[model samples]
Target: MDRRIDGLRVLACLMVVLLHVSSSHIHEFGPKWWSANVWDGLSRACVPLFFMLSGSTLLGRSESLTDFFRKRALRILPPLLLWSCFYLWWLWHNNAPTGNWLLAILRGPTMFHLWYFYAIAGLYLFMPVMRRFYQYSTQQEKIFFLVTWFLVASVYPTVQSLYTDVQCGRAGLLGDVYQLQYFGGYLGYLVLGAYLAERRIAWQKGAALFAVSSVGTILLTYWLSKRLGMPCEFFHLYLTPLVVLAAAGAFIAFLGQPAAPSSAGLQWLSGCTLGVYGLHPFVIDRLLISRGWMNSTGWVWIDPLIGTAAVFLVSLAVIGAIRLIKPLRWMV
Candidate 1:
């Protein structure tokens, strides 16, 4: 793999951390006009990029399913469990809903971040066979799969959500493999990343696709928002053409950079990204809320883009500080 891609991987992870920061305090960036819808709108791209990068990196790596599962589990599950404990602890301290004691143990992560870890782990267990099938797929056949994926994953759901006021999510029997297809909307990204990473698609062409699609998304999203009075946010849609465009553009744009030799500072921050992702919500939930950090400016009527960078830097510091703790240094 190219070092540039690894650098992009780092960027994408940072994007997720920053995304959580902004979400933790929606009052900050949520009101700005040009930038109001941007962060949350773009934040969805961050994790999708991670998935896509994961697909590309892991799919053709020639590891056995057992080996792949072992590696993937170690990489994600430990931190997930660690943070799950932290959130539940926080809830217990606050006397809030921690679920039934048994349910708390079963559900683990108290916030939404855990779902990312769960979904990724679920996908990891199944990727070996998917990879084999992917390898056997002709170019046309792959496109067909992608087309259906986009429709089921993004287009259909977006249309449905627009017409009806309801939330749509993964649905299937408890033990169903197809339950994973609920993540199908996300597969557009994962598959795109895998396709590009596998060298099945040319880099230049990918960049071009990204550029054209992203510009189109920005324009279309803006037009749709003005026309329909929609927020252009992603909540109502499973996947949007706009999100696919933005994420693809952002991923490629970041990937286009050359990697610098890792400085101790940069590498240290990189090492702390997982910790940052895990603990950021707790900070947002407990500290940010309790600390009274809400934007107090009367200028919000003008669409101020507040707290975008502030939340990220603050969260970065908090996560970095966690490494100094002797007992928990292993997780970060």
Candidate 2:
């Protein structure tokens, strides 16, 4: 793995942790709520970055479909199932009615963040076909796919939102006549990741673009939220053009930077990112937020920062302890 990519993973994981930390307080009114909204908007790139990282590493790799499934299942499924069950137990322990454990697990559990695992698993299933498509596609064909994806997936939704009374509901020309369904969703991020990884931009250029898009995304989200008198839905959608630009710029910036010298500690933390991502929400939502640890300090500006660090460290320690058991190490 590229050490820079590893660094990107660590950064994405921390951003995700920060996002959840900030999100927990999003409904609160006043400065803290505004701060949470801004932080949440900034971290919107985290999941898209993960998707792009997947594209960078996974696409164009030559492997038999069976072998790919086996490897991905081993890498993804175990932790997903284990953590899903853990979250279900946590839900029950907190007096949240679980109803049926098996059904909950089948329906992706009550835990919100675990939805990523389910979505990514579906992506893994489709990757073999996507890989073959990439192998056969000419440069122009790839560009066409990306452009079509952006128009249909990113632009169409925003356009539709402009008219409040229109009820397109998957019956529109784009969906029905053009059948734009195939080019939508996180697949764009995946292919965009692979495409960007193969190209290079100057660090200065990348940084400037990233700063502009990131600031634009944050400000736009803030404005929308204020206008609607609630959290903005548009800016946070992963496929939103602003978000795409922000994520792509940040990704390019990271790609342009030279890999830093390997530190054993950093490498270890990077390696543990999957575990951290899988586990951190539990610490944030259940252990800290539920216990009011986040509110105990009453310092709006400082509490989230303190709480985020605490959640990250506690989650890391828990994952580290899980790794100590030989049989369970692979699951985490």
Candidate 3:
């Protein structure tokens, strides 16, 4: 196992927790909103980093479809179902309206964060085929595929977004030139992850470039949202060019660093990440904020920092306790 990747997982999970903590207080006007914006924008790379790590580790592995399905199911399905039921009960307890239970289950669990499980499940179904493609393709062929995906998926749509009159879903010129729609999406990130991990590209000065770009991306997002009086969420999207660059840069940066000495503490915390992820939203939305434990307190930075740390530590303790149980251990 790559301890660097394990370390990255811990970082990504913490970013997600902080992102949610920041998101909860984002609606406040003035300084509070600005503080939340900084945290949210900086953490935009969290999910994309997750996908990239998946590609790095899982894409080239040798496994039969049946075996892959069985393994993935064992890892993901129990938690999905367990959390789905838990959230449904949570919703009912809060008197939150659920329009359709069946549809919600099909889409994701009752909580918004659980949608990643559904997306990963879909990705796992096609991963074996993708691995075969990776195995057979030449360097030029791989580059061609990534370039096409970048243009069609990332650049074109962002350019089109500048023109408000341009309606989405209409493919326009690029769509007519080739069947580009089928080739676009998160698949690129999978290939990208594998490509980056396999090749030892010398990213000289890349860290500085990435830092500059990330700062610019965050500032642009904030400025645009304020100017337009609407959420400039596209800038923060996982598939967007800026976010893709930020995530890729971060991955490479981590990969270049020397691995730390193995620590049982680190490994245990890393193992608890998925459980912490599943449970933190509840802690943030229900317990911390709802119980008045997290509040403005007139200190923008201090409040969110304390809240995030509290949520992470509490969730970690709960997950740690759950892991000690034999039968219930798999659910997390």
Candidate 4:
């Protein structure tokens, strides 16, 4: 295993927790919002980084469709179903308003964060073909594919913000008629990941790109949200140009680092990332914020960070405990 990938998993998992912890305060109009915005902005790359990680790790493999589905189902479907039910019960327990849990789930995730499961499931479904492409394509062709995806998937929507009157027909023509839609979506990140993993990047260059893109994302989000007189997620989107750059920079930056001494502790923490991701929201909503324990500090920076740390650690401990039980381990 690449220790760097393990390290990246832990970092991305923490970012996921921080994104949720700070998200509650982001809608407020004041200093709290600004602080939350900063935290949230920095964490927006979490999903993209995760997808890229999947790309790097999975896209290089050759497996039968049966084997692929079996492997992916073991990791994804059980937890998705179990967590969806758990959150449904949690929502009802809290008297949080919702409807038709069955339908809500069939349409998408019962909870917001679980949406990643759905997206990744879709990617997994397509991975067999994607893997073949990754295996057979020339370097130039791969670059061309990424360029096309970036232009259509990342650049096109970005342009829509500038040109409010941009026609869907024109986009349709470019997307459908040109067949560029095939190259769109999160698949590009997977391809990019596979490509980057094969090459070595200078840590200095990766760090510089990460720094600039991170700051740019924060500033752009703040200005846009303030301009709109409400919380805006334009720059927070994973597919947006700024966020794509930030995630790519982050992926390479961390992967470029010298390997740290092997630690079972780090490996254990990395293995628990998925479990922590599923359970942290429950910790946040029920255990922390609902009890008025989080965001209580007058210090903006301290509040979200503390809440994130608490949720992450609690969720990690819970997952670790669960993993010890033979029957329940598969759910996580």
Error of 1 at 229 (Å): 6.7
**Best-performing candidate as measured by lDDT:** 4
lDDT of 2 by residue, 155-213 (tens): 77656764554332222458778778788778888898898887877666766776777
Best by TM-score: 4
Model 1, runs deviating above 4 Å: 21-35, 99-102, 165-183, 199-238, 257-265, 296-310, 321-330
On lDDT, the stronger of 1 and 4 is 4
Candidate 4 residue spans exceeding 4 A from truth:
96-102, 165-173, 259-262
Error of 3 at 51 (Å): 0.7
Model 1, 1-332: lDDT tens digits are 36555566667766665565444323332445434344445455677777888777776667777888777777877777777777777778988877675477566447677777777776776788778867887878777777767666666556666566533333222115444364464555666776655443344654676556545554555666766665454441326765666666666665555535666666676666677667666665555456665444545322123443454566678777877896766665
TM-score, candidate number 1: 0.76
lDDT winner between 3 and 4, please give it.
4
Of 1 and 2, the candidate ranking higher by TM-score: 2
Model 3 misplaced regions, further than 4 Å:
25-29, 99-103, 165-177, 201-206, 259-261
Instruction: Give the Cα-based TM-score of candidate 4 against the true structure.
Output: 0.93
Cand. 1 Cα-lDDT: 0.61
Q: What's model 3's TM-score?
A: 0.91
